[model samples]
Target: MTDTGREEVVREEVARAEEELRAAAALLTAGIPRVAVTRAYFAVFHMARAVLYAAGYEPRTHEGVLHLLSLHFVKPGKLAVAHGRVLARLHKYRGEADYGDSFVIDEPAAAEDLVAARDLCERLRALLPDESNRRE
Candidate 1:
């Protein structure tokens, strides 16, 4: 795809991810632990991409989320390392919330992650003005 096409795709995906995040927050707020954790996870995923786009890298494929973060955001020394922790936790939580049959989500865990993701979003927005998600 051309540069412009790729940018559009990134924008669309970012929006989709943001919607999922909002849904996740709502689920959490409503005492829906399972669904809330799921939403918190995707919120981080999209948050990663929002940073990617602001850095002039648009992720279009499924691999693009980690791929772009690994590229630009990862090379900033300690910040990259910190993001790695976020990536690991989010990725595992994504799989756990989706596939693990006996997975039991707790309110504390859900609340903590939701707060972390919301804070992360604020930090990302500070860094990337292109982010369009609601400023939770």
Candidate 2:
């Protein structure tokens, strides 16, 4: 993709991250912890994608995104290992929340995931250029 195209993708992913965060919060407020956990994970996932796209990467799968994130950012110490751990943890929790027949995400767990997701998104957002600098 051209630089403009990549920028557009990055912007879209950032928007998605923001939207997912809102949805997660709303879901949690509505007493839907399971779906909230999934949305929380997605928030961080989209933020990761945005950061990767800003750096010219386009991971094809969720695992690919995690691997690339560790290889490019965490291993290089551009991001803290804790950030990577949070993403991985959320990924695992999201799987359980979405796919595990008997798995349950309580409100507290979903709330913690939301907090972690917000932190990860903030950290990832820091790696990108300021919003004002990007073309609309």
Candidate 3:
């Protein structure tokens, strides 16, 4: 993709990330911890994709996203290792919350996931070029 097209994709992914964070917060507030955990994970996932796209990489799977992020950003010191750990934790929680019939997430854990997602999103957003500096 051209730079402009890539930037557009980054913008869309970032927007989706923010939206998912908001939904996660709302769901937690509404007392739905399981779904909230899932939303929080997606928030981080989309932010990871945005960061990858900004760096000219496109991952086709969840594990691929994590691997690319670690290889391209975390390993190179662009992002903290904790970010990778949090993403992995959130991914695990998301899977349990979504598919594990006996798994349950408490309110506090869900809230923690939201906080972690927000932090990850902020860190990933920092890696992108400023929107105002991009050409229309």
Candidate 4:
């Protein structure tokens, strides 16, 4: 992809990230904790993809995104390791919320995931040059 194409894709990913966050909050407000947890994890996942795109990476899976986030951002000190932990935790919770037959994420756990999602999104926004700083 050309530079413009890559930039456009990254922009789309950032928008999707924000949209997922909004959806997560709405699900939480509607008392759908399990779905909210999934959305929260997606929000952070999309943000991680956006960052990876900016760094010229094309992650093909959830685990790939998490691994790349740690390799390129956390390990290199581009982003704090705590943010990577948040991604990993959210990923785990999301799996439980999505695939575990008897698992249900409580409202408190979903809320915590939402916060982590928002924080990770904010960190990515600050790191990406094309992302708006309107929320800052």
Residue 39 lDDT in model 2?
93
Candidate 1, TM-score vs. the true structure?
A: 0.73
Considering every candidate listed, which one attains the maximal lDDT? 2
Deviation (Å) of 123 in candidate 2: 0.4
Q: Give Cα distance to truth, residue 58, candidate 1, Å.
A: 5.3
Give the per-residue lDDT of model 3 (tens digit) for 67-96. Answer: 999999999999999999999999998888
Candidate 4 lDDT for residue 116: 80
Put the candidates in lDDT order, highest first. 2, 3, 4, 1
Error of 1 at 117 (Å): 1.1
lDDT tens digits, residue span 24-136, model 2: 99999999999998999999999899999889999999999999999999999999999999999999988887789987878997898899899999889889877612423
Q: Rank by TM-score, descending?
A: 2, 3, 4, 1
Q: How many Å off is the CA of 133 in candidate 2? A: 7.4
TM-score, per-candidate, Cα-based: 0.73, 0.94, 0.93, 0.93
User: How close to the true structure is residue 40 of candidate 3, measured as C-alpha lDDT?
Assistant: 91
Model 1 spans with C-alpha error above 4 angstroms: 53-64, 78-80, 129-136
The C-alpha lDDT values of all candidates are 0.68, 0.90, 0.88, 0.86
Worst 10 residues of 2 by lDDT: 127-136
- Residue ranges of candidate 2 with Cα displaced over 4 Å: 131-136
